[model samples]
Target: MTNNNNISLLTAILFFSILIPLFLSSPPSSSTVSTKTLVLPLKIQKPPIGFLSTSKASNSSNNKLSFRHNVTLTVSLTVGSPPQSVTMVLDTGSELSWLHCKKSPTLNSIYTPLSSSSYTSIPCSSPVCRTRTRDLPIPASCDSRKLCHVSVSYADASSLVGNLAYETFRIGSLTRPGTIFGCMDSGFSSNSDEDAKTTGLIGMNRGSLSFVTQMGFSKFSYCISGQDSSGVLLFGDEKFSWLGPLNYTPFVKISRPLPYFDRVAYSVQLEGIKVAGKLLPIPRSSFVPDHTGAGQTMVDSGTQFTFLLGPVYSALKTEFVRQTRGLATVFEDANFVFQGAMDLCYRVPPNRKGFSDFPAVSLVFTGAEMSVSGDRLLYRVQGMTGKGGDWVYCFTFGNSDLLGIEAFVIGHHHQQNVWMEFDLAKSRVGFAEVRCDLVSQRLGALGLNT
Candidate 1:
């Protein structure tokens, strides 16, 4: 069955909580960095049950489980000497990019560092190993074999441990020599392939340790799709012509120290949300920083659904239900239990005309508004009700407070077919509606056939 709950509760909240110093200092100048187009072929990952709603790339029988189609993004990478290609999740909220283990990789191989000629560990006494001033150095003899260690925890109490090390990293045909990363071997994973979604995590936050900063690129972008398992991850300046025009919102930096986590996520002033032509009753503060500068909202690619603060979500849902009450009808019987993360769902008419006739939803950022129409704003949750039920689509918006947190999370579910550009130099995030599958030609991956 399609797991009703996503793969892991932690999967929906890709937010990282780290308590160690990493091997990242100064990022090399973008001028010194060669501009390269690294194609990040995104895979549609299936979330485990109970909390999961996204779709998986697999075509197994479980496809009939939930009609709700929620999906997470992942990409393949070549790590270590002689290059071992491994598929990893592309996480914009995480800071450190790590591998599954220390081994030489095969098609299905674990990363065995002991077998790689290019393997070398950074010492425990290194500056990167020390998280804070006067902190004790990691327990090691200060030698090549003496590696610094780090532990990463998620909101669900699941955790992983790894040692800091440097190895050659390659994407497409582009190779970065001596890239710093974690050589991880163990974690709180239950099944062996349970880690298939994350043999490793490719970090894309603003921290110095992130894959984006380490590569010295001031900008990067990923276009995610709702229907297909394919999309594009672009790096450096996008001077391409095929991708059409863009809209932008300045990145917000109202500083508020999170309890035990660094403020490394990409935040924006989410002024308000609009349903149909009317604005929701929630205050802008519901999604913005307070006097303490905490609670500013961010958009994450790894998270599968859009999350709002509890009260803000209530206002949004109230307005949505008010506007879309008669647009589509579904079987809301005793057999139809609300198990998916998205609270608002409907059975699209067999003609599918109900979607086009439905009310619209839009998010007003400080500089621009992201207007989502019909099907794009909702997920077509397939079989959450059995084959006997009448349901076609489910809305993807939900309250994050229900999950015990309150950060406005704009996940991939809402970003489908949206071209998002993260320009660090301009300090803005640009969004536009485009078919993600067309991105290959937009990047000229297929040669100018259009």
Candidate 2:
């Protein structure tokens, strides 16, 4: 979905879903026998270009989102004693799950402070509040009255601010006690439609207080099919016999002490990229961790478009242009020149039809491999440069200039139509190609015996 002449500035903020293990304290040993795996169906959506969004159809009051929002997925589950189902974004890039605090008495399914007997506040001086770990290094501080205060900011200045507290969270048949979360009383809305849609964010990173950590698990995995179908996100004990011939690669740990690395993300080694079976000229070192200790490749559920450091993007674009010699050069605006964080969009002429011959793009991971077909490599659009314009497909991959510094990001666009598993026990990342919508025979569910 490309933007019209007046491109929308709505950008998908980095939700940094990192699942690092605990080093500050001895993490509770994951109970293998009794650790019940929970299965939650995720509703995924591809909201326009250069943005992110998704919510239940019933959440229409204030959840007006732009036509061009980013690719975001939401999971609906209840919380508190009576179990009020609330929809929150399933972000691997975030640390703690949170909810928008209710101000009015009649707000739909929001968290009411006066209600819920399981609610417990984390004091500013409490041990949980003072712990400085990755993703949550700035551990929540206390306000003047000694209330545990938490504030989170997203990529486009959108934010969530409130008190830190714990409540009973019930998703599917699984229930968790003392689930850590922020009572979001205030925050920024990218647009009007997003005001009420800002129900909350569910964090599943590696922080001690993250959903996975609180649940006492070392591993989890999600198979994303795409926008049309609901996918499975399983926590604990995922045996991928359904995805035949699983290729596993070491899930390297980049130390957090370095200021350059976010430390909250799961990092992987990228050897290089190939287009049409030909390797790009980009040096392998460019994809690896640089001297500053940054630029390692990562896979994230929150990011919509795959981003490459400047060096990789330049080389890839050059090779791509060289391969597709006859394709239309997608021009934007009156200048018809490419600049900014995103460019390289071309439209087919009136007489001509769909993309004729596009080359395939592949990522060469350390040990694993992902073959990206040409269709997934570009964004097909009907109108963009002008009204009722010819259909075009924008270059879905982007470079460092648009993202500020050269940053390596493997967004969900590349993750589609594949089976991916993040195994924390062996510290490895595994992948296989398969149909995501097919119902898989379960190895485990929350209450059912495997």
Candidate 3:
């Protein structure tokens, strides 16, 4: 009896040790397991995830979500003796238009500054100028100083700083009176060299002091093409069928600056998936914001991928790994194990699903839910070594190891013609779709391979 009691005690200790942690970490579920417990790990460390305290602002009056697709625009820079054509990222999150300066002595190689004479400046005393400066955070020098000073700080610690100047800028066939742009004099050396390609960014998103907003077009809409084409940003009430039914979410005031050109928050509903006409449980989160350090949905067109936070990232990765247990081979690249390519000839285990048969991963935005159409879910990056050994894969979700922020990022190239509308009065956001083919042609003409 004594021996049996001792044995029983030891067994109980071991059982509880393993079981307690599993129960603590498991995600919320209706069913309970007798002996098994789920263990989910938290990702971010410093600032805890979730809502922070903030002051309440009046919700904007326009609360509907909608979009315009494939609207084209002509962007030019008047720096040299003759003007030059340049592509621009129309972003509402941002407040200024900037160009990559090739000849400005003070300009960084990553950013090209337009000539001083290329734009007209609003004096400090002007009423509109004061309002623009006050609302947009433009410097005091912009008041009386003909040249407007502007700066953009990115989540990756990269920044573009320059003087704000107004120049003749056109989008599609509609030419605005004059547009204010930032003549970039400095490059964000912290970012990769690829960030330097564009002439400048066009801030068209909500709350930004761009030409469109300053000119009083509060209800502007635009489109961006997909990876195959140059995207379009339009300002006006034009509508499109591709925008689908409008869903609007109130814009939550951000405690910190957002990853996009401006601070805008969105609420998305991910109706579970439909497999073979049957619905499967789909994950949903309300506060997922754009990943910082990555480019904005409106600007930084060079990035080819998007990122998500740790919880979502881990969930997706675990599911994919479990589904492709047999076909998945771990390849070491840059300190991470990537799922490598495999042939489908080998038979998969009865319990394990093959990679080839994995269901498509869909991302639902306000306007549409896009599915991954390719065989491979990860986009493999060429290894730094010439031997093609240490390749890196694009992360679909998680904090960017490079950016160090807890957010989701949508690359501009992948989400062209997707319109983001911000209504300050209504405190709501909207989305729409656009055509990407013509945008692609324009990008090709400018040596940009989408």
Candidate 4:
């Protein structure tokens, strides 16, 4: 839907509904298996233009879409009997799909169980409640009604208290009955502005109860376009020549339980970092997770900026400052930090229209590399300017230490314009840089025929 100013976002949920039935209805021999693509068009809203105000900036880093708020990758899902379409965030960092069940004055939509003919809450005696949720950060418990219930809290301080239930889910032509999900009865969000507009979240993490795992999909891919446009989310192993040959990296295999890291996270081995074509002096061992499992690098679509450990961040910031000494004047004011985390601020000259003089930054993984240059290297923190009315641009990377999270994170800002394929069967992640707008256009034109 477009705003009154003519800025458009995704208006519909496009799907190739034939996929689920083809894979689930019958057992296919190796020779008979179909590798057809299942598509879901993704919607993302752009941050407003310069000099905008947001009340939810400090709630969490995920809310900070590179200093812009309310940016999320969303898709529509039809849930309950006599299904109703609900907008959901497609999150790779969370495990359970949930819908807001309680009606609130501020909420746009809620799934009322009394209205659904097929809604059935799981009893506390059910093993599905106990076994399936054992590994989750927030495990299931029995409510006063002897129903399976859970209370989940996000880093943003938003929470959902819900009961586990089984209900029918409709995805285009494919209707799956008795699907398990969370029917939340109560919740509170620090960012009620965006929460009021959407229903809930769809978890796509590596955990057992995630949407991809529940659907039995061996692989999935998504292309996040520039903020103004729509993108495509795909499931199954259909390869496109236009995607080109992707660089592959193996996900870290944890043999035992981790002390600090989320065991089910999509983590990869990070080799090193390079600034201005020169590799940093940090040691490779520093990137490896210690006995406490603290340093593994994870790819999280929910977060907005990349975060590194304190030592690694110091090395990077030092090298970056060294290379861009004369390009722009550093904002040396003690209070220049943004959100109390991003401290590398610079005052660009009034005539400086671009950041071409700044050095490029690269994150080198085992068999892949993510390079950031031009506008990607620095984000303009609008609504706030430096002395002499010069615009301020801060480095996009942040310190993971600020969050007390010991692991490194690669967030959404770096994933733009790239096709990321998470192959669960092979336990590998494939990435290739491409114009996501082209993929969105091609998929939009093909529609559900594919």
Q: What tens digits encode model 2's per-residue C-alpha lDDT throughout 1-450? A: 100001111123333322221222222222232367667776675434523223311123342222223446667778876776688777765566788876633234477756777777666666556664333534466788697777665444455578777777777666676677778787664443433553676776555566776767688777777545566677677554566887877765764455445454556788889999998888767877766556766666666677677778888888887887776654444323222344566665656543436888888988877877745777654223333555445677776455354346677667776777777668777778776677332433222333
Instruction: Give the per-residue lDDT digits (tens) of candidate 1, residues 1-450.
Output: 000111112234233333223455432221244665555566667654434334431223443232222345777777777777677767775666777784422224467787666766766766766542121112212334576776665543445677777776777656666667777766764223335445577778676667787777889887876656677787777566666788889888645443322256676778998888688777655776555444556777766667776788888877877777776664343233232235566666455544666677899998888877776666654434323344446566776665555467677767878888888888889988888877854565431211
Q: Supply candidate 4's per-residue lDDT for 156.
A: 44
Candidate 4 per-residue lDDT over residues 1-450, each given as its tens digit: 100001100111110000000011111111222345678788774445553454432223333332223557777768877888888877776566778999888799888888898888887667776555545545677899999887666544456788877777654444556656788888777566667667877777677666777666789898988644578888787767777899999999878876555666677999999998899999999999888777878776666667788899999999999999988888766644554357788888668867777888999999988888777778776665667888777888887665445677777777888899999889988898888888888877223526
Q: Give the TM-score of candidate 4.
A: 0.85
After superposition of all CA atoms, the RMSD between model 4 and the true structure is: 7.9
TM-score for each candidate, following the candidate numbering: 0.80, 0.81, 0.54, 0.85
Q: Pick the candidate with the highest lDDT.
A: 4
Q: Candidates 1 and 4: which is better by lDDT?
A: 4
lDDT of 3 by residue, 337-418 (tens): 2111110112222243323454556555444454543322443322211122322233333233223333343433334445
Taken over the whole model, the C-alpha lDDT of each candidate is 0.61, 0.60, 0.35, 0.68
Candidate 2: C-alpha lDDT: 0.60
Model 1: lDDT equals 0.61
